[model samples]
Target: MLQVLSSESAQEILSTLTSDPGTASEIANSVDQSVQNVSYHLDRLCEADLITPTKTWYSQKGREMTVYALATERLVVQFSDSTD
Candidate 1:
């Protein structure tokens, strides 16, 4: 999770989602990245539980598009002492 959060692309994606939930293409456009690149980061973000598919929409061509939003509004990280 930390590794995923450490990425600049991932951070940008998260930031983009804050204003609106969008499909991969929408996110890519907002971030000025390629769709493929955005999809890769979206997958990583999903695996990290940072984002989730909130709804599904269809394009005029009838292709299914998954809209993604942040799983949580805030994230808190804590480290435990090994000496316990």
Candidate 2:
């Protein structure tokens, strides 16, 4: 999961999920990205075990949609303080 966090898109996805679980469409809209692009990022996050999808019913459409959210609250960060 930490490895996936290295990617910029993955990081952005995680940040969005941290706020709330959302469908690929919702995420794309928020980030001003295409649905396919958001789906690709979501797949990587899912593969890394960083996010999970919840089966939800969209009342307005009366259809099921998968909402993705962060699997955990703890986010990992790596930094270097060395100056040479």
lDDT of each: 0.97, 0.82
Off by over 4 Å in 2: 77-84
Candidate 1 segments whose C-alpha is farther than 4 A from its true place? 80-84
Per-prediction TM-score: 0.92, 0.77
74 in model 1: Cα distance from truth in Å?
A: 0.6
Per-residue lDDT tens digits for candidate 2, residues 1-84, read 667777887777778878889999889888888999889989988888788887774858687778888888895667777882
TM-score of the candidate numbered 1? 0.92
- How many Å off is the CA of 42 in candidate 1? 0.4
Give me the displacement of residue 4 in model 2, in angstroms: 2.2
Give the TM-score comparing model 2 with the true structure, all chains together. 0.77
What are the RMSDs of all candidates, in order?
1.2, 3.9
lDDT of 1 by residue, 20-54 (tens): 99999999999999999999999999999999999
